[model samples]
Target: MEFKICEVLRVKRLGKKFYEIYVKYEEEPEPGTFAMVWLPDFEAIPLSFAGWTNGIARFLVKVVGPTTAALYNATKVGISKPLGRRAPIPLSTPTYVAGGVGVAPFLYMKEKWGGKILYGARTKEEIPKFIKEEIDEIATEDGSIGFKGNVVDMFFTKPKTRDVYVCGPYPMIEYFRKRAKEIGNIKAYFSTERPVKCGIGICGACTINGKLLCKEPWILMS
Candidate 1:
């Protein structure tokens, strides 16, 4: 449940009010698992692993509130991420649908499990360059990058038959849920960006439907 910071690789600024911090974990946490990051004099928050290799873990953090602000401003701190439910890897080819920071976990998945990735962001500047190079396809809400319009919109144009894995805003996930029904053979995994005060599900901050988002993620079939 506890992890030491092996190294802080890079902290890059993305667009406005966003940063992607790459921290190497002492041990590699499983893909899709999140870590509870501890900041001095502040509450710990759950962050999904963006990518990991050679005892390293990366996280794409958006500075939204006090907890995240403390992390972004802190020079060095102890962090721990208790492993959580890991989505099963598809038996067939996997197509990733990611929007904004929701693309974080998929970025890690792309590294371990080679597959087609479709990433979308609000604008061209908000997109991460590293993700662009790795993904097989990309789309944007604005015409500034990749395809013009929402990432989900592109899905309607060239509907994929492969097993689908997606994470993003609720609207996007809800849309995919409906689309998946029309286009069967698609399995989807989604995560809600709820405030998880206690990573262990004690505080009950992260709950979706009747399931706990951190412990039991909803898996939809279409």
Candidate 2:
């Protein structure tokens, strides 16, 4: 629960509303761990670690609220380590399914295991050009991209049978959960988000079905 006021190394706007903020924070956070990021007078919000290089931590931030918008407007920010639990990384690399900004947490996995990305957005314009994956499968609602439906649609036709890691809206998690039941050998790890008022295990607001996302590594549903 240590906090540091880190210098902002770089900031790049992704698409229209999303941003990539690279901070000079000396924390070796495991993939899927979130940081409690904040500005001087703003509320701290949890942002997943997108990637890290040369002692700098990368965060993919979407401008959704006042706190996030305030973060977008700052050059330096506060970051804390391991706010959330580490996501489960399979012994054999897992298939990454990201809905919108959910793709943030999995960006670093590409470097580690050279995995493929199945990312979904509303349209092609929403896709970030910064992402350079070997096999990036995209799904958009309007058919402006790779597939005309959701990432689950891509999963049904061609089930890879490997472990699958998913992040995004709760409905997307449920969709994959149901699909996992139908399919025989898909191991789905859902990184769910609750109203995490406090990044640490102190606050009980982040509990989902009696399981705290801040304390649990992964929420797996058979």
Candidate 3:
């Protein structure tokens, strides 16, 4: 995989420590695809592939670690070609469930084909105001928003027929996958963070369920 050194065109702050960074790139990425991003001295990290807006590549970044903090403050960086499976996009409008920064990956899909999203956060303050238009229901553990429970609560409130795409914590993903069968016949896909060192499947560092994360579709459970 080749890392393209690019300049950051802009960094728009979406929430407290959350940023929408625009980079100079020529290609667009599909939903769930990621880029191996890195700085000169920092190790490459896989980041959610947002979208190419007006010819600029975008990424939703949250300050979580030293490298991420550095990215939040960077002007130039290295970004790899789109990685991860190009899972079939839904034909009809789909429903999405997200936790915190998990919403980042679906920005492209939400824009390509309008969809309803059930977003969850710890508090109202943690929710990014910019994503309000895309959210159908919101849940906050602190009850600072729409519902006073988890996104799963929103999922189970009604029998879902629309294909569901979920992203967030591991337990959150597993929880939904377990109960998904009970929620009727809804096709569900997920994207969870894992120890991904290589964007290609050469390294087994990101193996899960006998599948290399770098090559498989996001959170597809058989």
Candidate 4:
């Protein structure tokens, strides 16, 4: 289950604290599955698969804690094990709705699935140039990007696509969930940013509403 680091490529700067790190996995890893990254003198943490090419997998990591700090400092190679079930990409054409770092996983999927993306950010500076090109529409809170409003607000303005994939903060997910329910035709999947300490469902850190987030995420309806 251990994967070797084939290469470490810096894709872009996501802010002063976040950097998009693309590590080529020794073997091809599943999209939407996370890898448990081992860092020196700290706990192993789960990072979502961003994208992969050849034999590499990508991760969008934020240096927000001791373990992440150690990862940023490590110069030597590392390894990771795929831990959870792979999230399925909806077969129907999708309109991806992403905000902030939640956009990471979709960026990778967009490469393969070829779907329209609706990306939102706090300002023009926070939106990476690479992401801007990939998305079909863009919204900004500060009137610095494509549309001047929240991503949810723009959703009402556009025609309802049949499939939607949303990932971001809890509030954004909740808002989209309500909107999706109202639309009636659009199916959706949401990625929750809960802490996953033990990837095998023992820690219970990733439970939502009564179901375990890791094991029963898809069962969540409403």
In order, candidate lDDTs are 0.73, 0.77, 0.81, 0.71
Better candidate by lDDT, 1 or 4:
1
Worst 10 residues of 4 by lDDT: 213-222
Candidate order (lDDT) = 3, 2, 1, 4
Predicted candidate 4 versus true structure: per-residue lDDT over 34-105, tens digit per residue: 677775567767777778787767777766788776666554435666656666766777777888777777
TM-score winner among the candidates?
3
lDDT tens digits by residue: candidate 1, 1-222: 464654566777765656777776677766677778877677777788888777656788877789877676655656775457776776776778888778778877777777778888878877766666767767877789778988877776775645677788888888888876786665677775777776776768787776677775435533
RMSD per prediction, one decimal? 2.3, 1.8, 1.6, 2.6
The alpha-carbon deviation from the true structure for residue 84 of candidate 3, after best TM-score superposition, in angstroms, is 0.8
lDDT of 3 by residue, 192-214 (tens): 77888987998899887788878
Which segments of model 3 are wrong by more than 4 Å?
Answer: none
Give the winner by TM-score: 1 or 4. 1
- Give per-residue CA lDDT, model 2, range 147-218, as digits (tens): 898887776777474667888888888888887777667777877656777877787888876788777736
Q: Lowest lDDT 10-mer window, candidate 3?
A: 177-186
State which candidate, 2 or 3, has the greater TM-score.
3
After TM-score superposition, the amount by which residue 153's alpha carbon in candidate 4 deviates from its true location, in angstroms, is 1.9
State in Å the error of residue 167, model 2: 0.6
Order of all candidates by TM-score, from best down to worst? 3, 2, 1, 4
